[model samples]
Target: MATLPKPAAISIRTVGPFDLGRLSRLHKSCFEEAWSRSDLAHLLAMPGGFGLIARLYEGGLVAGFDAMRGVGFSLCRVVRDESELLSIGVAPTWRRRGVATSLLQASMERCRAIGAAQMFLEVAVDNHGAQRLYEEHGFERVGVRPDYYHRPNGERVAAYTMRCDLEARCGPSRGP
Candidate 1:
């Protein structure tokens, strides 16, 4: 049998203000309606808002363009005992490689560590893959929003509202 190459190492870090540009670029690469730097800044500036960035590091190269590349990101916010996942995306080339899973898991852990008892998210009704992922992670569809997403071509799409009990799935909050 041919020997298979090992998977590259992926590291995730909390997004800082200085990383807005990189986050914007990665969002653009992953979504057609990417959030602008100003928009990301606004989101991060909100109270209880937080973001995470995932980087894929290949081999020993650690100081150049190809050494570390942004592959995915998740934006979330906690208000009192509830949290919402604002957005999440993974680069096309890195899809199906566990990047999104890692981001989601990290986001959940972060929210649970704070004081969030549950997490909510919206996904386009047609996005079955994302719905499956959310379901696998203890989320369940609670409701639906009519015409929630507007496309560039002027079409509106519906979305499903999903919720996950953080306290049940991740135990209780550790601390602030």
Candidate 2:
């Protein structure tokens, strides 16, 4: 059997309006079309909306920096018993280093704590690596949205809608 790689040391924390700039920059680094700070702040200000930031720590330093560096983020919103993962991404240099996984796990736990029974997210159909990650974390593809993503160059792409049962997959949240 192939052994899974161990994740790097990472710390995830809840973020608010003060983190809009960082979140916006991280989002821009991960996607072709970037979300502005205003957009991120708007999302975070909505009812049931929240965001998480992931910082990598190595020997108390991040990427040779003396301080922890924000490398990834996850945006989510919980409505009633359901939650939606609005966006999740890691810096290009931080990909494959388990940053995304850490953010995802934290997001699920946060949603569970807020009484969410299920969590849903849409991933670009061409992103098989992300699909695998979501599947490994108990998400299953439920449907597809045609032309869900529009590129800056006028190209459109479909996305897979995946869902995970928070109660079954994430269980109860442990106090932070």
lDDT string for model 2 (1-176, tens) is 65544445788999876788899999999999999999998899899999999986776334466447888999999998899999999988778878888899999989998889999999999999999999989999999999999999999999999999999987774432
> What digit string (tens of lDDT, one per residue) describes model 1 on residues 38-107?
9999999999999999998876654567777888899999998899999999977778878888899999
Give me the runs in candidate 1 sitting further than 4 Å from their true place: 1-6, 60-65
* Per-residue error (Å), model 1, residue 20: 0.8
**Candidate 2 off by > 4 Å:** 1-8, 60-66, 172-176
lDDT score, candidate 2, position 116: 92
TM-score of each: 0.92, 0.90
Pairs of residues clashing in candidate 1: none
**lDDT of candidates 1 onward, in order:** 0.90, 0.89
Top candidate when judged by lDDT against the true structure: 1
The true-versus-predicted C-alpha distance at residue 112 of model 2, in Å, is: 0.7
